[model samples]
Target: GIIFFGSQMITRDWIFNEFGCKFSITIDILCTVVSNFQVIVYTVAALSVERYIDAKLSLTLNNKFRTIITITCIVLIWTMGLLMPLP
Candidate 1:
């Protein structure tokens, strides 16, 4: 995210060759997508679900179950985030 914003700020008045420009733009887009959608959005959702489970099923939910659930959510979030850009 910082890289994307920094590149934008630095490139405002500068110019790059064809390959450099394309590579910079690709990095910016990839960073923006992963930072905004994958990390922030999905993480919040996962935390919310975890909290809900903890609150509602505190007695039944053990550390092992919670760990499994958390890992599954993380994997799903990354998988969805990465696959979303694909056709």
Candidate 2:
């Protein structure tokens, strides 16, 4: 929903209509794409690795420790993506 607002603001013509600069839409598009890819791909990979570790340990996957691990994984995704080059 926040992205929807960003998309609208990105396309508005009034400022450019006055300033005579064309705003290409690719910036928003690339940001939208890379952000999703960054989050979803990393989260899924984390889940997969957690599942593997849980299976190897022969333990139920929904323990408090697992929850902590999942949150840490998501935080890692955000931190790592911050250091990565954005599209």
Report the number of the highest-lDDT candidate: 1
Identify the runs in model 1 with alpha carbons over 4 angstroms from their true place: 1-31
Q: Each prediction's Cα lDDT score? A: 0.75, 0.65
**For all candidates, what are the clash counts?**
0, 0
Misplaced by over 4 Å in model 2 are 1-24, 60-62, 79-87
lDDT of 1 by residue, 1-87 (tens): 345447668888535567776786787688667656766688898899888888999999789988888899888888777766554
> TM-score per candidate, in order?
0.60, 0.57
Output the worst ten-in-a-row residue range by lDDT, candidate 1.
Answer: 1-10
**TM accuracy, model 2:** 0.57
1-87: candidate 2 lDDT, tens digit per residue: 334445558985334332232333455556667777887788888878877897797555557777798788888998776545343
